[model samples]
Target: MLLTDTHTHQYYETDPIKREELMQRCLDNGISRLFLPNVDSASIELVMSQVKVYPQYCFAMLGLHPCDVKENWQDELNTINAAIPQHKIYAIGEIGIDLYWDKTTLDNQVKAFKTQINWAKKLKLPIVIHCRDAFEEVYKVLLEEQDEDLRGIFHCFTGTLEQAQKVIELGFYLGIGGVVTYKNSGLDKIVQQIDLKHIVLETDSPYLTPVPYRGKKNESSYLLYVAEKVADLHQTSVENVAAITTENSKIVFGV
Candidate 1:
C-alpha cells in the first residue's frame, strides 16, 4: 500500500545519516510521497534540499507562514516569491491566519494570507493552509477570495464538524494529521462523520506526533499510525485508507 503525507517538515533534519534513516523508515512503512511546505524565506532551502535528494519522494510548497508575519513580512514574501520560479512547487502554503501565537499580527496575517492566495490563483496551484485559533478570521478571507481557482487543503485541520463542512464547501480538502489519533482530540469523531474523499492524511512531522508515540519527535513513518487510526474511524483497513488518501493527495498536488 502506498501512503502519502500531504504535509510534513521532515527536511528540518539536515544530517545526511539521520535524513536517510528517516526516508528509509517512511519507505519501510509504505509512506512514499511526502509534500514539504516551507514556513519562511529561510526554510525554502531546507525544503528544496530534501526534494533535491529525494526528488521521487518529496514535493515542495512555498509560502510565508502566518507566525512569520512580523515587521519584515513583505521582505520575506519577496524572497519566497523570487524562489518560486527557480524551483517547481505543487502548492502555495502552509499559509493562513494564526491568532494563537500573536493576536496583534491579525491584520498582517490576513494581508499575507490574501497575498499568498493570489499567488496560488495566478499560478493555478493548490494552497495548503495552516489555520490556528483563527477559523473565523481565515474563513472570512477565504469567502472573500473564493473562486474557481482557489482550491487546496486545510493543513492540520482540528476544527469542529461545522468548520469542516464549511471548508469542504469551499472546494478544499481537510488535512487530517496525528491529532486524529489522540484519544480525546475529538477529531476522530469529526473525521468519522466526514467522507474520506474530503480528507487527506498528514503527519506535520516533527510537530503533531500521533499516539503510541505522542509527546515524542514525529516522523513520516508514524504516518502509519495516523492511517491506521483513520481506517479504524472509517471502519476500514489501513490499505484502504492509504489508497484513498494517497489518491486524494494526487488530486490536490496533481502528482
Candidate 2:
C-alpha cells in the first residue's frame, strides 16, 4: 500500500528528532514519496536540506508562492532560478494567484504566476498551482498559455465541478487534500463524479488537516484520513484510493 503525498512541507519541522519521527511515521504508514513545493526563497535551503537527507522519499519543486509575491518578486525569482544550479526539480510550483489574503497584490501575483508558468514550459516541467479565491484569474492565465507543452496539477484544489472539468480539459490534474474530508465542503459530491484518473491526493501538511484531525497541525501520515475520505466518496477501499492516487501523482511528477 504505497501512498504518495504529492504536496507537503515536511522540512518545516526544524528539530532533527521531530523531523526523523515525522519521516518514520510516513514510512510506517506506507507513504514513501513526498513532493515538497517551494514556498519562497527562504524555504529553498530548508527544503533542499530535507531532500538531501531523504533523497529517496522527498522530491522538490521550484517557484514563488502567490502569497509571497511582493515588490521584489523579480529578485525572489532570481534566487529560485539560481537554486536550479544542479538540482532535480519535479515541478515549477506552489505558484498561482490568491486573492484571499491580500487583494492588493493581485497584479503582482498574476505576473509572477505567468512568469512561472512560462518557466515550467521552458523547462518542460509540470507546474503545481496554488489557486485561492481567484480561479477565474488563474484560469485566464492558463487559457492564454495553454499549449501542448503546458501541463501540471492545480495543487490544493477547492473549486467547482465546472472548474474541475475545465482543468481536466486544460491538461491538468485536480490535487485533492484535507478539504474533501470536511463536512459540507461539497467536494465529496464532485469527487464522486470525477474519475480517479484526473484526481491526485495531497496533504499540504502543517495545514488543512482532515476532519478527525482538523484544527490540529497536519502531517504526512495523516494523509491516510484524506485518502479514506476519498475512498468513502468513491465507495471503494482506502488501499484502492492509495494505489490509484499514487499512480496519478507519479503521472504528474513522472517519478
- Per-prediction TM-score: 0.99, 0.98
For candidate 1, the TM-score is 0.99
lDDT (Cα, tens digit) per residue for candidate 2, span 53-90: 99999999988999999989989998998886568889
Clashing pairs in 2: none
Q: Where in model 2 is the C-alpha error above 4 Å?
A: none
CA displacement after TM-score superposition, residue 64 of candidate 2 (Å):
0.1
Find the candidate with the highest TM-score and give its number. 1
**Total residue pair clashes for candidate 2:** 0
Local accuracy of candidate 1 as per-residue lDDT tens digits, 84-158 = 999999999889998898999999899999999999999999999999999999999999999999999999999
- Candidate 1 has an lDDT of 0.96
Please tell me which predicted candidate would have the highest lDDT against the true structure: 1
> Candidate 1: worst 10 consecutive residues by lDDT?
92-101
Q: Name the 10 consecutive residues with the lowest summed lDDT in model 2.
A: 80-89
